[model samples]
Target: MITDPQGTILALFLAFCRMGGCVMMLPGFGSGRLPPQIRLFAAVAISMGVLPVLWDLIYPKASAPGATYIALIFTETLIGIVYGLIARLYTLGMQFAGTILAMSIGFTAPGGHDVVEDATENALTNLLTLTGLLLLFMMDFHHVVLRALVESYAATPVGAVIDSQKMLITLTDTLRASTMIMLRLASPFLIYGLMFNVAIGLVNKLAPQIPIFFISTPFLIMGGLFLMYLSIAALVRQYADGFAPIFTSF
Candidate 1:
């Protein structure tokens, strides 16, 4: 029953290399809040679960001697990173939109520790990013990603040479798509800010004696918050919906 233990261990390690690489940069699972130990074990567990299904595809390749096996280690890790980044880039778009939203709405409060990342971010930006990420978790985004990873073996079998050009193209495409979606989500606030500022500028010109800029600050913040309250649910819902098509297509 324990014959070829070395071969079996090699196969498992090969599987872990890919799974671990993917988990290393995955969105919710890869967040700074999660301990590295937890991520490591999760990747190992997932690799174990997937190994049986992929044994035929991986065992022969892993058991090979010499430099070819070493090459596979690098290629598999690179492929996993490419796949993980596809989802990671999309999630990062929420942060991008949040920053723009905060700036446009004049909600640039003092920075606070971000719940997702170590960096300091505006309160409104943090709120938006946290809400979006939480919604993605609630929607079980990781399940979708795991399913994609399982399916990926068929598209990219073990031992195949990694194509750096294709990986670059895929990454670029994901960036373009995510940027477009984020901009669309943030466009309303942009327009609102532009119109509000233009009106304020005219008011300042018309009534030069008044400190209109200072007086309008409260109104700008209030209006932006009110607008966000009215539309945030829809905005987040749309953002979540956009994720599926991207992941599925990728």
Candidate 2:
């Protein structure tokens, strides 16, 4: 039953190019905390699993040997990166929202190591980002992303020339949509911070000798923490819910 070993291997590698590219930038799987070996093996395993399902669609195109095959490799990898970035942008938006939330609420504690990346981040921002990502994992976001990758082959068939313009548009749209959602999530904090700071400023102007601004720091942090306690569950739940529509629509 076996024949064309070379073709099969070639097809598998092609499949790997896409799946690996996607995994390289996927949210939970792509976190810097994860060792590269683990990610590599995970990608390899996923590619192996997917290759069988896509063998018919991919093998024919893959069997051809020439400069065209090299082009195909680049095209497939680009498509995968595009798909991964769609999900990545949403998660990055959460980080952005967290940073804004921290700054607004005066919760800018000394930066600690980020749970997901190499950079240092404020404690509150780290908490928010970690909680949001964990919730997404609990909700099985990876399954949705994998399913999307499979569906992508249908929307953008194997060996189709990459559409640079469309790819750019899709990425831009993702950034726009994610930013709007993150801003909405962080809006309450933004408003609260603005009003609180304004009141503090007014008091400072009225009673210039009291050192009111310095005095308010503890209260600001306490109130912000209390507000976060009251609303964080809903914030994360909404963040998780927002992902499905964005990923599925694209």
Candidate 3:
């Protein structure tokens, strides 16, 4: 049995790298505004917690650091990234739903505060996204996230090469399913918005002298906001229900 302190440290560092990569992209803690130092600190905490469990499984020899051991670190990091990306895909559901809702409510404009971290998204969309994230936290969804992380170790082991084709297929299926779900969630709003717009357009067309467009704007906004409030509870419940099954497959 290999018993070098240097090897142990190296092994730990490598394991930490994989864990850190995953934490960097994980939800809640991986928010764009979070400070890097804080993210790193969280990663460290997670690595420590996971180390004892993984050390024996990953660090077979404590002797000299061999080439295979070094390669395993890269594999572990890749596996971590894949796992994290799979979890992160769920956040897209919010984006999908929010975009549809905003479009239906006529708020999908090129508004300010349209950027979050590295991506461009309007304020309304961002608001809904933030709401979804906050709901996840309020519900202690992080526990579910942690459970998924632990489950990944069994589903997709460390030092194992990922099946890229399979992952791609899964990703595509996730995006499609999420978008469809969002469309379904926003269907009521979409129908309402469409009917309202058509009616308002007809009024404008019939009476060219009236300022129907300006008058209808506030009514539309008020109606949409009310509908959103009405739907909020059901929306949250649906998200929670849908999210639980996602981890089971991964």
Best-fitting candidate, scored by TM-score: 2
Q: How do the residues 40-97 of candidate 2 rate in per-residue lDDT, one tens digit apiece?
A: 9999999999998988899999887689889989999999899999999999998899
The per-prediction tally of clashing pairs is: 0, 0, 2
What value does the lDDT take at residue 197 in candidate 3?
96
TM-score list, all predictions: 0.97, 0.98, 0.85
The global Cα lDDT (0 to 1) of model 1 is: 0.89
Q: What ranking emerges by lDDT with the best candidate at the front?
A: 2, 1, 3
For model 1, residues 76-144, the per-residue Cα lDDT tens digits are 888788888998999899889988998888887889898998788888888888898889889998888
For all predictions, the C-alpha RMSD in Å is 1.1, 0.9, 2.9
Best of the two (2, 3) by lDDT: 2
Question: Per-residue CA lDDT of candidate 3, range 88-144, in tens?
Answer: 777767877787788787774685553334578877677777777777778776677
lDDT at residue 15 of model 2 (Cα atoms):
92
In Å, residue 194's CA in model 3 sits off its true spot by 1.1
